[model samples]
Target: MVDILEKLTIVVKRGKADKNSPYPPDLKGQDGADELTAEALKMGFTPDEVLQKALVKGMHLIGEDFSAGRAFVPEMLMAAKAMKAAMKHIEPFFKSGSVKQKGTVIMGTVQGDLHDIGKNLVAMMIEGAGWKVVDLGSDTSFEKFLAALEEYPDAIVGMSALLTTTMVNMKGITEKIKEVSPKTIVMVGGAPLSQDFCTQIGADFYSPDPQGATEYLDALVKSA
Candidate 1:
C-alpha cells in the first residue's frame, strides 16, 4: 500500500500522466499518476489519503524544486497535467464531502492583461494542493472578481498581470474588494509585480511562484 502511494507521488512529481506517457524519459512505460491513483482507490485507500499522502506531497516537492530554481515552467506544467489526470478520480469524493477541500481560491489575470499561462499555472498548483479553484481566466475585470467573491464569500482572491501597465489595475481591484469586504485576503502576482507593489496596493500577499501562494492558502485554512 505504501509502495503504491509512493509510486503515485513519484509519477506526479515526474509528470507522468499514465502508462503511455513518455515524459521524463527514465520513468517511461511505468504506470503513472492516473493509473496509480485509481489503483490506490481500488486498493481501499480513501480519496483523502490518496490526495494528502500522494498528490499533495508530490506537488509540495515540485513546489520546493521550483522555489529553489531546480525546476522550470515546462516541468511544472507537466506535473500539473499529471495531477489533473489523478484529480479526475478524487473530484467525485470532493463532491460527496468525503474529501474536504482546504478553501476556495478566486483567480484571474487582471484587466487589460490577456495572458493566462501564469494564472492557469497558479490555479492548477493551488487546486492540486486541495483547494477549490475558481478560475476567471485572463483580462478579468474588477466587477467580475467582485461577482465571484459574492458567490464564494470566504474565498481568497488572486490577481495576476504580466504587463507593467496592466499590473496597475490590480490596485483598483484590491481597493474595491477591501471596500466591500474588509476581511478578504487579496494576493497579487505576475512578472511585473513586486512585494513592494503588493504592499503599496494594499494587497495581502505577493508571490513570484504558485507554490508560495499555495502554502499561504494552506496556512490560512489550518488557522481557520
Candidate 2:
C-alpha cells in the first residue's frame, strides 16, 4: 500500500498522466497519476488521503524543482496536467465538503493585463496545496475583485501583472481593496514585480515563482 502511494507520488511529480502518455520516455506504458489515483481510491484510500499524501506531496517537490531551475515550464506544465487529471476524480469529494480546504483564495491578473500563464500557474499550485481557489481570470477589474471578496470575505487576494505598465495599476487596486477591507491580505507578483514594489503598493507578499506563492499561503493558513 505504501509502495502504491509512493508510485502515485512519483507519477504526479514527473508529470505522468496515464499509461499512454509518452512525454516522459523513461516511464512509458506505466500507470500514471490518473490510474494510480483511481486505484488508490478503489483500494479504500480516502480521496483526502490520496490528495494530501500523494498529490500535494508530489506537487510540493515539483514546485521546489521549478523554483531552483532544476525544472522548466514544459516539465511544470506536464506536472500540472497530471495533477489536473487526478483532480477530476477528487473534486467530488471536495464538493461533498468531506475534503475541507484550508481557506479560499481569490486570484487574477490585474486590469489591463491579459497575460495569464503565471497567474494560472499560481492558482493551480495554490489549489493543489489544499486551498479553494476562486480564479477571477485575466484582465480582471477592481469591481470584479471586490465582488469576489464580498462573496468570500475570508479569502486572501493574489494579483499578477506580467507587464511593467500594468504593474503600476496594482497600487490602485491594492488601495481600493484596503479601503474596504483593511484586514484583507493582498499578494502581488509577475515578471516585472519586485519585493520593493510589492511593499510600495501595500501588498503583503511577493513571490518570484509559484512555489514561493504556495509556501507563503500555506504558512498563512497554517498559522490561522
Candidate 3:
C-alpha cells in the first residue's frame, strides 16, 4: 500500500499523467499519477490520507526543486498536469466533505496584465498544498476580486502581475480588499514585484516562487 502511494508520488514528481503519457522519457508505459491515485483509493486509503501522504508530498518536492532552480517552468507545468490528473479522482471526496481543504485562495493576474503562466503555476502549487484555489484568470479587475472575497469571506487573495505597468494595479487592489476585509491576507507576486514593492503596496506577503507562496499559506493555516 505504501509502495502504491510512493509510486503515485513519483509519477507526479516525474510529470507522468498516466500510462498513456510519455513525459520524462524514462517512465514511459508505467502507470502514472492518474492510475496510481485510483489504485491507492482502491487499496482503502482515505482521500485525505492519499492527498496528504502522496499528492501533496510529490508537489512539495517539485516546489522545493523549483525554488532551488533545480526545476524549470516546463517541469513544473508537467508536474502540475500530473497533479491535476490525480486531483480529479479526489475532488469528489472534497465536495462530499470526506476531505477538508486547508483554506480558500482567490487568485488572479491583476488588471492590465494578460499573463497567466505565473498565476496558473502558483494556483496549482497552492491547490496541491491542500487549499481550494478559485482562479480569476488574467486581466482581473478589483471588482472581480472583491466579488470573490464576498463569496468566500475567509479566503485569502493572491495577485500576480508579469508586467511592470500592470503591477501598479496591485496597490489599489490591496487597498480595496483591506477596506472591505482588513483581516484578509493579500499576497502579491510576479517578475516585476519586489519585497519592497510588496510592503509599499500594503500587501500582506510577497514570494518570488510558487513554493514560497505555498509555504506561506500552509503556515497561515497552521497558525490559524
Best by lDDT: 3
The 10 consecutive residues of candidate 1 with the worst lDDT sum are 215-224
lDDT for model 3 comes to 0.94
| TM-score per candidate, chains pooled | 0.97, 0.97, 0.99
* Clash list (residue pairs), candidate 3: none
Count of backbone collisions within predicted model 3: 0
lDDT of 3 by residue, 1-224 (tens): 48888888888888999899879899989899999898899999999999999999999999999999999999999999999999999999998999999989999999999999999999999998999999999999999999999899999999999999999999998998899899999999999999999999999999999999999998887887
Tens digit per residue, CA lDDT, model 2, 1-224:
77788898899889999889996999999999999999999999999899999999988888999999999888888988889989988999989988888899999999999999899888878887988899999999999999999999999999999999899989999999999999999999999999999999999999899999999988887787
Off by over 4 Å in 3: none
In candidate 1, stretches whose alpha carbon ends up further than 4 angstroms from where it belongs are none
Q: Give per-residue CA lDDT, model 1, range 20-52, as digits (tens).
A: 988989988889899999999999999999999
Clashing pairs in 1: none
C-alpha lDDT values of all predictions: 0.93, 0.91, 0.94
TM-score: the better of candidates 1 and 2: 1
